[model samples]
Target: MGIRHSSAGKMIWLLALASLIHVSSLEAATAETVKQKPPRLNIVFIFVDDQGYYDLGCYGATEVETPRIDTLAQNGVRFTDYYAAAPICSPSRTGLLTGCYPRRTGNEVWVHRPDSGTGIPPSQTTLAELFKSEGYATACIGKWHLGFSEPYLPANQGFDHYFGILHNLDSYEVAHFEDQGGVPLLRNGEVVDRNVDPGKLIKLYTEEAIGWIEERVASRHETGSSEPFFLYLPHTMLHEPLGVSPKFDGSSNWGLYGDVIQELDFYTGRLVDALERLGIADETLVMYVSDNGRGPGRNQQQPIRGSKLTTFEGGLRVPCIAYGPGIREGHESTVVAHAMDWYPTLASLAGISIPKELVLDGRDLSALLLGETDTIPEFNQKVSLNAEVPLRREFHQDLEWERIFTRQEYLNAFFYHGSHGALAAVRSGKWKLALNPSLTLYDLEKDPGESHPLNSWEIKTKLRGMAIRFQREMIEQGNSN
Candidate 1:
């Protein structure tokens, strides 16, 4: 909620100052008083593949140095309790792009494979489409993994330009090579590289992203337009077939995976440098988050339990950092925010209204991001804002924030779904109820590992009821499949 400074607006001031500098002080004052439309913020979201919560230095990483990403975190709002939409790739991406739970979109359960006939339904509105509708230039670079077919491709999903592989890099390995050809690098759905080397993917995707950004800036200058842009750069590394550029091979003390992580840090720096080079750093809002959490290989995801594919804290919670103009620097927020919330938060930032037909599980987080609110609304409420003309809430509980956000996620009952799309747990505030094992409850604040159990029949019954109500609502909407 600070100053929305656009590069174009800054340029306008510079030119105005150049002409008015020779004039009297009164005339020069006009340059400062001039009114110009601040360009809508350009968005560059760098979504990682299988990064653990403690994978980056900012998140307590030690084996691998992630200076670039760490710096971004140091100078931005780092969310300690940030959660991805799902524990796996496709469902996670689906939740992020569509602003709905993967189940709501019927894309939950598993990653979309090459043979999967369907993808994100055309009826669903993606983040790209939402930004594009507001006239922002949209592009999707790096791993797509949504679908390889026509209607499901990035081009049809509202990205003006699409680059990189349509699916995962694992398909190109020796085991699956016979059935699935090497992941072909594509440009607007046309194969550019027949066999994309996973080792060079970081550099290639980095170059593509930087070049595309440079082109967009050049186009803006040439066309004399201030159209903002959106770039979804989902890197392909840190998942499987760990890749690294030649320069970074064996660069870390942690071996191949560390090398890959270092390479990622380097390329991420390149992207940030490109933005600064084009004088659009302040005009851009950059976000770094993982699509899902990984096993506690080198970095234990510390304090969190379980790993990817499971419905544990480690599987859901991951590192998230937001930087750029209008955001407070060097802030670590304990407030719980999920990937799904980005959809509505970005809409509010860009000043666009969602189409009324859509039903989003994500709440608008503009207030939280702007430091206006510390806690989210009730479980049933859709956003951080008061709904009615005055305000109205349907929940019966302690709604006051009390300047504490450690238990914010519990305010909104979060149901955890495993990789296979089975309901495993329900979390409300500080307590979590694991469904399958006779409805055992755990105080997550004290036991993030989900180790200790509290034998309380009342709490368990209430949590179980919450789960039942959630499923009922989901089925009522016909999205419980």
Candidate 2:
């Protein structure tokens, strides 16, 4: 009996010893993983005003030279089917910064002029706010057309620093309204220059951005801090009444427009080179996108119909390039992407935790950007819209403007066209239902220009149902609120 008990005790001791050894090994492995984890990446978002889909050399612009932008595409991923959230400027920028449709934020029509009282509300959280909250240095250097009011400015919206015009350069001399003569160039909410030269604005903006970047880097090195940065550089080039510096006045065969684009490219190159020199190129995510499509008789947005102010492909589709570390070189993604997607995409890339309470219309593109997946997961779903999901109204604010959508509206791939505060059309996948002038159905894949209309009952039914459901839900949600 004693001998049997001794044998059992020995076996128990051996098992206990093995378990401890396994636990110790796990602890060691976990510590190593924690130590080797990469630091959060910096982000540089370059937003240009009114650049067309084919404006960049890589996107098939034979007339204008965009060597730097072309190099950016060659070094990273270029998106062919990328689109601006709105067909015009103000709403497009609102979507980009907030990750919500322009209508949702109450700015749908054209851009805000100096006389406009309304602007992006203070209640909405911007991209700069998100980065700032995460301890990242934030700056906005260039055009800020959202608002010129005290509360609507970039500084109030979360930028640590802001240097640019309140509205378009044309606002300088050409008065859009009485008492709104010139656009005042500001720095951190103070009017720095009221009569700034339009030709020198681009160069000035570039220099300011570079100086900020250099100072930020130097300060970080001096302090031995590892804090990342978020730079939102929105250029005013290519907008109507385009002007270029003396050095690049007649540089392109395609005329003044091409000259402006080339100079834009040169400044872009300078910025990228600065990053490389600072040895942060591999630790940063650089993206280039246009605020909206170009105007008529400007840069080419060929094979797509309609221009700025219209809800056609030419007005919505714009060039998008993603460069820097982890992005596959020379890769082209035809996946459907929007300007709003950048809000969530950048958050994911920088390892920032997105607020769970926030209703985001953007999808995380980290998998696609990292080359892990060819397409976004949402696109793979059989049924895009899930109406069964409960709609949540977390933040309620009473404003002068009406709300466009609830959280439920973002569940589907449906895009609402509200260029002038009225629903002109609704798009779901390849089908577009036009409600203006006349009821028409178009298959964008077959007729990108919306030149041909398809007579299909099935498509019309599907699209009509989506539009009806969206409107119904919006009304119901609004009443409940």
Every candidate's lDDT = 0.75, 0.72
Indicate the residue-level lDDT of 261 in model 1.
Answer: 88
Best by TM-score: 1
What are the per-residue Cα lDDT tens digits for candidate 2 across 215-264? 98898899988888999999877787788899998998779889999999
Task: Name the candidate that leads on lDDT.
Answer: 1
Judge candidate 2 at residue 44 and give its lDDT. 90
After superposing candidate 2 on the true structure, give the runs of residues whose Cα lies further than 4 Å from its correct spot.
Answer: 1-30, 171-182, 295-301, 379-416
Q: What TM-scores do the predictions have?
A: 0.85, 0.84
- Compute the lDDT of residue 419 as modeled in candidate 1: 88
Give the residue spans of candidate 1 off by over 4 A.
1-36, 171-181, 297-301, 377-411, 479-481
Error of 1 at 103 (Å): 0.3
